[model samples]
Target: MSTDSVLRFITAGSVDDGKSTLIGRLLFDSQSLLADQVAALYHGKHKRTADGVPDFAQLTDGLAAEREQGITIDVAYRYFATPARKFIIADTPGHEQYTRNMVTGASTADAAIILIDATRLDYSEHTPALLPQTRRHSAILKLLGTAHIIVAVNKLDLLDYSEEKFNAIKRAYSKLASALDLHHISYVPISALNGDNIVTASAHMLWYQGQPLLRLLENLPVANRNSQLLSAPALFPVQRVARLDGSSADDFRGYQGRLEQGSLCVGDSIRIEPAGQNSTITAIYTPAGQVEQAQAGSVLTIVLADDIDISRGDSIVAADSTLQPTRNISASVCWFDSKPLNATRRYWLKHTTQTVYTRIRQVDYLLDVQSLNHRQDSDSLQLNDIGRIQLSVQKPIVATTYQANPATGAFILIDEATNHTVAAGMITSLV
Candidate 1:
């Protein structure tokens, strides 16, 4: 597959907003479904909608529990390709309790299709009425750094494909999108059930002039990690040690990892972190063969001139431009576990490859999803709560602010005793 041909995106919205159906329609209309899969849609005890057509939502709601409950409980990923582009769709749950799943799905998305049910709104005066879940998902997307956002106004068939209703939603959501500072924001009227404005234009909605959902996604530009190279140096968070026992070289040791950002070449001076030792790149090897250089996304084995004391969590960065190791950091955190995050609690912080014990120094404030306002009096972060917190790590970690370089700036808070991931955090500043 071509590098630019693949687009990783997710579907998110309030419950019963047709997120799964939208995905099923995208797959079905694209002719990506197999004959047996199509047969199951008709044969299984699967329920059909009021229109007498098989419920396309069944395509994604694969779990028996999900089919019985008629709600997406976990993240369902589907793959499809058009003549123009290949897509990896993450169908995320829309319930309030499953907000963490949506965040996890959208973390790597190039764009997001947020489905807003048109029937729920009063289309008289161009007003946009949204559920609380909508606001929560929007807030999390902003925090997670999802760049492209397309608001898909779904269930237009229920509204008789009225242009006024679609326009009203567009106006209302455009205001909200502006408030969230989302880039490349666009609106489309679609009915996932009837296949209107999905893969092709809907005849009922001739008044609306916009590309279909699939086309818009195909045209959207993927974020270029290599573009950030000018500002940040190559960052390699060692995943494992690669040792080869061969006839010619008995002591061939290489560090293996994905080159997260920037670029690296042979003979460049690199600094290994936590210990802060300097070495030169003796060789760069890929599966095909050794190459002169590698870009941001390549995973390769790098042999250093000097065998230094390096482990899985240590980072190798350009010597001239390296992240400063620090113990205290202020970050924006999304609490996901059942346990609330309190200032007195200690957790395991996994940043890049390094795992260290960390304590919550302070809970600065909790963000109100609807208004995007910060409440200062909060002492703890509940499930799916977004808050800013101060953390004091047991050991210093080489890092940069998330905005500067995402590869080196993101981390997860894990429960030390249970080993469950409790929160996802982004470094805002070094303290």
Candidate 2:
């Protein structure tokens, strides 16, 4: 059964687990790469790996430093298509320093292909040892709401392409997956460097009766985009003010933004949050034509009946919605900066489109990545640390819990002095 759905997925694992090589192999075997991309492998800088083939890892590890260091430092995204499906792959960095990059890549992914190097594990027994990053990334993927998880047992060639070894690794990961409550978990055995069990069934691994990697992706069901959005309250974050024909004679003003959640219709009453101004939708504008109704994910211009003082960073939400506007936020934050998070220091908090001054009122606890438990003794958090923290904002923000509405419940902490993103946060509870 062929499915033409587009799947957005991320490949994550510990450093040198072959995340980039897997992507390169997928592109190469699928005939997805252009002629020059393949030809360049024969020339400049792109040297072959030990297998005497063009370095497939070079396809996704595009940064100069990454190439020089033989690592992936940033999130390198690549797109390819088979007749049955189209795919967007985010090959994220596996280094501890770039954990934030992995978080960013998995945040929007529908599924995650987490690679495990067979060479590193003692797979003679049923429960093989797992790398720390494997468990950590699995937890992060679950936290980010990735719907599907595929534990790809990579580099089986190193293990003599043994089915028993693959089964042992699968059994080991299953225990961890069950602990994390990850429902849609599957496992596949393949060597990305040798192109076995990737595009087609492997002759070396005849015992693996499951479909190839490409086939599994081709038939994987993608969750409907509209269903989740429609279940949440309508959210419209004003991007910019649109004035038609630059004319004030008619006082024409339209607010433009992508409808982030739910559906909106003409004559529907809505409230502009933080200001609490109420108005009725006078009209909706789209490139095709004017419409009386618009669904989530649509980018449209909305005209309100009453003249309201709305600007960029303002949220227009359903009038009867229960989303609370608050200055106190308690969230699970992943600290991204080299400097530890200081309770006495203030930051630039950005949520949706609103930016305001904020500070850590309290650090509730820090998470132990290995055990996935909370430790309350920490006074501050360092780089790549995930913790529960309370934030006091200078202005009230209209937000919902991330479990309820992801679009309105997420935010980022930025350093004002250097203007770098320091933390990524998801609202757990608000006061």
Question: For this target, which candidate reaches the highest lDDT against the unseen true structure?
Answer: 2
Query: Against the unseen true structure, what C-alpha lDDT does each candidate score?
Result: 0.86, 0.87
Tens digits of per-residue lDDT for model 2 on 268-367? Answer: 9999988998999999998788999999888999999987889988888889987657999999888899998888878999888779999999899997
Which candidate's TM-score is highest? Answer: 2
lDDT by residue (182-202, candidate 1, tens digit) is 777889999998899999999
User: Candidate 2: what lDDT?
Assistant: 0.87
Tell me each candidate's TM-score.
0.92, 0.94
Which stretches of model 2 miss by more than 4 angstroms?
50-52, 122-126, 244-247
Clash counts for the predictions, in order: 0, 0
Scored against the true structure, residue 228 in model 2 reaches a CA lDDT of: 74
Root-mean-square deviation of every model: 2.7, 2.2
Clashes of 1: 0
Question: How does candidate 1 fare on TM-score?
Answer: 0.92
